[model samples]
Target: MPRRRQAVTIRHVAADAGVSLQTVSRVINKEPNVRPEMMERVQASIAKLGYVPSIAAQRMAGSRSYLIVALNDRERTIAGWRNREGTDWVDQMLLGGMLTCAEHGYRLLVELVDTHNDHIARELLGAIAAIRPDGVILTPPHSDNPHITQLLEAQGISFARIGSVKPGAGFAVAMDDAGAARLATDHLIALGHRRIGFIAGPNEYELSGRRVDGWRAAMAAADLPTDHLLEQGDFGLASGRAATLALLDGPVSPTAIIASSDQMALATLELARERGLEVPADLSIVSFDDTPIVRFVHPSLTAVVQPIADVTAHAISLVIAEQAGQSPSTAPVIVPATMAVRASTGAPGAARPGGGEAQGYAGPPAGAGIVTEVSSDH
Candidate 1:
């Protein structure tokens, strides 16, 4: 008869390794406090017996596993984004949440709703209820949605927004879009480019409107009339190219164009080349959200630097603070932007005679646009 196979148990491993059951547990669970040599022995015994740890048994032991959930809406576009494997806005939010959860000894779970889903807000709320996480994080424009906001409130769940909501809304860590755009526009004006053109990002994007507002405000302050010189983009390089093409082909071509994002700005350069226009010589340009790639472009981009790290950190802090029973400020914390001027701008030049020639350009380039830098305010 074959020798009887020995049963594998935590006690057997501990005894074989000349240690206590708790020591075996410490080694098995990969927890702290086990002596190195003893841990090795326990592992050797377990290997000798071919022992396997039961996940169900571990869960049944009343061990706590903390988790947090994040909800995002990608229906609108985010500026300064180059779609690689994992650098998008949604990924940033998830990583930020993970960092926050790690600080508090918790896990982060992310759920992405379908862009075409109509009842997304409702479905998201249901997921939250089922998961029952310690807390949740919301990213714009979802954070700005009133219906979703009301639903979260009704459920009595705690959450924080990664971007700004309305003035009276609570718990937001966001960049000041209008302020930053103002700075970008101002940089161009100071550089002497009076025939400035504005390229708007996605219409549905909240920041797009804010940036345009800043552009308009700056122009208005400078006593400049903005009419028919603005074109919209879908926050893609292709959109930027098309918008710029349209602007250049029109009768009154602007000497400088301010793209809402860097990808769009780069696209503007490509279009300018195709149209036989030289950057900073014939047509200066500026873009927003200074991504790393901007510096590597043929003409290093003149941009509005957005602090991604700060925004992420602030959002994490807000969510954790909300979970700790400390309420975040009702006012959104606005991060400042900076003017990273490079080779894309210069002084204004003579506009094509009779500004009416540029009838369809949407807005005029007359005033200073707001530019902001990163900040750490609650």
Candidate 2:
């Protein structure tokens, strides 16, 4: 019979590195002041042995679980996956969050919970009891949920809120959603589109309102009438289609339309085709999130590319930092979002200046992205 390899643990790493068990723990927890050469040697030994530290052992070795919990909207996320619509928000989040957590010797865990669950406290408590995460991150609808924030507050857990600007308990790590929306709207306005239409996300999300506000503000600034040009969507394909239909069938036909989500934007594109209108020629379209699929469409979408990975990484850092008693109480993060000019948008009568296909914008140089870190009493 083949021999079974024993599971590798921190002790094996310590023994192989010829260091004290505590030294290995320090390296695992990313504690400061460890000698550089010792850290290297310990890490080298761990790699050689393929030592995967046990999370339970980690919990026992310290007051932390070394786990960062991220809460996402349960219903919407599931629907997106089940329908195979394939939103890349979670993927981008993992790319940024997992990498950041690994650097800090932590793990990123995602939990799906109903945003409006009446037993929200119980759901949160159960998850909290099971994982005992070092910190929590609230995304989208949950970010604006006061109940979750209140419970996390009562339980003394460090959390970070993404896509929220409300003054609350958890650290607020947010994107410039409004600024990004304004950027998109302004781009369309500059392209000689007079009557631009705007489709907004659901009211449950705070960022949705912020985006709508930006679009409205930009239109008002351009001295253009926004009457009959705004429609509401739930960030879903069906809702987007309904909203797009209303905008197209309204009193005045808009030359350009901006949908607040990739799904919604795709719906707009679909609706336009149904109406026999050419993208960016007969109609110009812009959308948000800059999802991966948008680039492959017949008329690639012009999108507001929020720095998803960088923003997520920054949020993870803030959560871990706050848990470690570091500062950054209530400063606004300024992660800049860029407009990816594509074939979908144009000068009302003409296609966008370049070839319709375009690459998503890579974010700014490292260390320049601003992230809001809200500190807690904990």
Candidate 3:
């Protein structure tokens, strides 16, 4: 007759090790104050018996684990938001969240979602039900989405937004887009640029709107005319190039141009080159989001630098505090922008019209183009 197969159990581990069940339980659970030798013995016995703790049993015992789920909009991609090559906002966000979680003995889960559909909140709700995370972190357009916000609220799932929200929202951590835009505009105005043009980003994002609004407000406050010189782009390099061309070819061109992002600003520079126009001397230019590569270009770009790491850190802190049952901070931080000057801007010396070309500093004449150093607080 075949030998009877032995049943495997926690009791078997205790019996085989000649220890009581309570000692084995303490060892298996990693409870505090277990003797070193006793823990070793219990572990050895558990290995011998092939004893595995059942997750189901732990859940039924009224114990719950902490989890944080981060949700990002899949439709939009943020430059310098990745972890590779240069400093990325995503890595900083993860780092801050991980550090906070480790300190509080919590777990973090990341989720990327597409915002094209109308029911993203529904999908997020499903994820919440499946993972049962303590809270969720929303980024970009998703933070402004009313559907997801309502669902998360109705379900009693705590959530934090990673970008600036309208005034009166309880919890959000983000840079002041309008404030940043005002600073960028102020920089150009101080540099003697009266005919300043703005290249607007996509209208789909709230940041885009806020940035443009800030530009208008600043220009008006400075007694500058807000006229047809402004053009809109889709926040892509190509769109920026097209918009730059439009503004340049118009009857009333601006002496200086502010592209909403580094990518768009780079495109403007490229367009200036294609049109045989010069930078700074002929047409001063500035961009936002002092991304890493902006400094490495042929002519370092003048830009408004956002405090990416600080913004993300604040967001993570809020999320972790709520997860750990701590009172949330009163107001979301509105980080300031730094104005980084490089070779991309100059005093308004070039004539707008009449005396021939788009009169401004046109780099070095023709083939003798001079490369300039880029300055950024990256």
Candidate 4:
């Protein structure tokens, strides 16, 4: 290897521009009262020398750290990365936030904080001390936690809540979880599925409950019976497996199922196979999250896409803009979720009553579990 290239610094820019360090600092920070000619000359020197200021340098004026911190649940995030499961949300969020932050000359930092820890305030306090970030983005449980929001508010820091609809403080960014579920449930109803089972994620997540509400809303609207058709999962494989078992083995088996997470959907698929049931034939499955893996699974999953990246990017913009005195509205940003129709869902497998022609999306006969045909008003 030849000589290692030396990193360019602000000092180099000042020297190249034949100006004092204070002048260069003001120019870099865009302080008021700097003559246009002087600012232009310093900027030219900075461009020519390819001088990139470090975060430490950027914070020398003590106004901003130029970093946006996003907090996620430590346990789940670690497990997701370790297991390589359907955990595309974090990756998508980071990608969108980082890219959007770059446009504002800010950096993104992802901090994992345990949701169950009683010392959450202490943990957040440590982060504030170490990074002194200008803003924060709270995800999932943290988003709905009053403790986290209160702490950030007391610190006078701008923040955004993802997947939260709670009132007060911070920017609230969320997807229409209920609407997404209703759309999925309607799809099944339109396919002549009367007894549709819903696999809900943990209640600790507000979004999970909203999805349940959506399913119930749709079923009630269609005048369908929901008895023994609802079960709870933890957005994990085991919980999904157990929920699927309960739904299938109950008094009345569902003609179709909607799972709140991709992993749970996979478990449903596995259980269906174990029961000698073919997808779209014996049991139709609709998965939530729609992670990259869902598309590649055997008999690809029909899924609800959460638009995680877009939501995250919007959150970043709101937080940054608030810090810049833009005063973005506190009203929740409702980015709607959409469905990806795939191979995993179709008409109930059992033949329609009296052999009526199957309606909705075309697919092979689902199997022998037919339900009464009803006009779907949803």
Candidate 5:
């Protein structure tokens, strides 16, 4: 049997550097007021001896656990979002949080709690006690839940909210969802779409209302009536498909439709094909989120590109800063969104007297333009 190498310890480094163990510990922890020459000697000895600091020991020396917990709601079912892999937004947020945590020498713990459950506070409180996280991050519907925030506050825990526009208390990071939705609507309007339809997400999310308000604003500005142009969806493909069918079968059909999410937008595309409508020729479409699915689909969708990953990273950074005894920023952090126009949108077809499009009326291609930053106040 071959002999196994022994693990290196701080004692080895301390002896090698001809310094006391306490001096080596102070140097390793980067404590203030250490002599520059002594610090250099300790570091060189540690490197030469291949000595690695144990996380357990580091925690014992500090008041922080250097761990953050990100809580997401499992009860909110976004249609066609989850698969064997995972949902796009959740995966993106995890990546952002994990990457940021690694950079700060911290660990990220992701938990899915059912916010809809009556006993959710009790369940979450138990988890908090077990994990004893240094901070927490709340995502979507969970971010808006007052009970969760109240419990965290009662426990004297630090936390940050992601994707929340009006995070009543505590730190928050979000993009201008209303402005993003308005940008999508304006894209269709610029392409000569007068009767534009909107498919909104579920009412459970505050963002859904913000998006609807944006659509209404755009329609009102263009002097267009929005009486029968809006349909409700649950942010799922099935709801989107059903809403599209309802909108198309109605007396007043829209030439262009903006679905609140990429999944719903794809559903709209599928339904349009079944109805024998040629994309951008007979109808135009725009979706939000600009997820990876939009790029790979045939007749790639025009979408509002919200910076989900960046917003999540910012939230995690805020939590870390707060845990490190830094004061939170007085103003909320707002990220901006852009528009990615592709083959899915163009000028509306000329309408006949009976609401049918005239043949050989292929619309011009959509122009590439940037979505300006609209004010976040809306």
Candidate 6:
């Protein structure tokens, strides 16, 4: 039988680095005021010795699980929105969390919870008992759920929140969703779009309301009326398409439309094609979620680039830090969002006799002259 190799220990690392085991322990725990040269020597010895610290041993030595649980709402259906592979927002969040956890020698576990369910607290408690995660990361809907936060607090579990409109207690990370929406709406307004349409996400999610508020704020600032231009959607492609079709068939149609999600924006593009409207000429479009799909689509969508992955990663980091005995910040960590102007938006056109463009305004230089194979079916 072959002999198994003995695992490297802190004593070995100390001997190799010419330091005490206590020094090795302090360096591994990332304590402050360690001599720089000694710290570097210890780190180099650890690398050269290929010593993989046992998370369990570390936990036993101090107090930690080195595990994180991310709770997301499973009731929110994506439907046709995620038909195109790799565009799912959940996938993005998971990827970000996993990567960040791996870097910190921590494991990430994802759990789906139906916050709307009557026994959600019980179910969450059961899951927590089974996993016993060091910390938890709450996604939208769950992020704002007071019950979940209270449960965590009562159980003595640390948690971080992502995408909460009113983040309360513990570590939280979120982007300025309403500000991003306002930026998108203002872009259309700047391009001479007065009668602009908005397709909003479902009201159950707090972010949906924040986005609506942003759109309303921008229109009000521009002295534009929004009563007739706003439409509600379920954050799905079908709802976006239906809402957009109804908006087009309404008594007064908008020259430019902004949908809450990239999938919704794609629906707007499809509907415009069905109605024989040329993108950026007959009708301009803007949307949120700068996912990878938006970049490859015909007339690449102009979108509010919400830092979904970044926020998730930051949320994981915050929980990890909190679990490591760091005090949680009272204020949420706010990530900034930016606009990615693509081919889909342009200056609005003057009215034609039958909703045709009297004058076609060219879009930005980057979007100019980019052609696609979509047919005009009107």
Best model number under lDDT: 4
Question: What C-alpha lDDT, on a 0 to 100 scale, does residue 274 get in candidate 2?
Answer: 94
Pairs in steric clash, model 5: 79-236
lDDT of 3 by residue, 1-103 (tens): 9999776776788898889877876665555678899889988887877877654443454344456787876644433245233444456667777776555
* Cα lDDT, all candidates: 0.67, 0.83, 0.72, 0.85, 0.80, 0.80
Error of 6 at 117 (Å): 3.0
Question: In candidate 4, what are the lDDT values of residues 273-365, reduced to their tens digit?
Answer: 999987876788998888888877777788888878889999999988876656778899988777877767778765544534323444334
2 or 4, greater by lDDT: 4
lDDT of 1: 0.67
Rate residue 55 of model 2 by lDDT.
Answer: 78
Q: Which stretches of candidate 5 lie over 4 Å from their true place?
A: 1-53, 76-82, 350-378
Q: Pairing residues by index, what is the TM-score of model 5?
A: 0.82
Q: Write the per-residue lDDT of candidate 2 for residues 1-378, one digit (tens) a residue.
A: 989988998888999999999899888777777999999999999999999877788788679888999998899899999999886998988899999999887899999999778888898899999989999988888988888999899989888888887887877777788788788878778778899999999899998888888888889999999999999999888999999999999998999999999999999999999999878777889888888898789777878887778878888898888766678656656576777776677666663336432222222222443312211111
Ranking by TM-score: 6, 2, 4, 5, 3, 1
Q: RMSD of candidate 6 to the true fold?
A: 5.6
After superposing candidate 3 on the true structure, give the runs of residues whose Cα lies further than 4 Å from its correct spot: 1-64, 78-87, 167-170, 350-378
Instruction: Tell me which of candidates 3 and 5 scores higher on lDDT.
Output: 5
lDDT of 6 by residue, 151-191 (tens): 99899888887888474666768888778878888778877
Position 269, candidate 1: lDDT: 89
Using lDDT as the measure, name the better of candidate 1 and candidate 5: 5
Clash number for each model: 36, 5, 4, 8, 1, 0
Query: Sort by lDDT, best first: what order?
Result: 4, 2, 5, 6, 3, 1
TM-score of each: 0.69, 0.86, 0.72, 0.84, 0.82, 0.86
Find the 10 residues in a row with the least total lDDT in model 2: 369-378
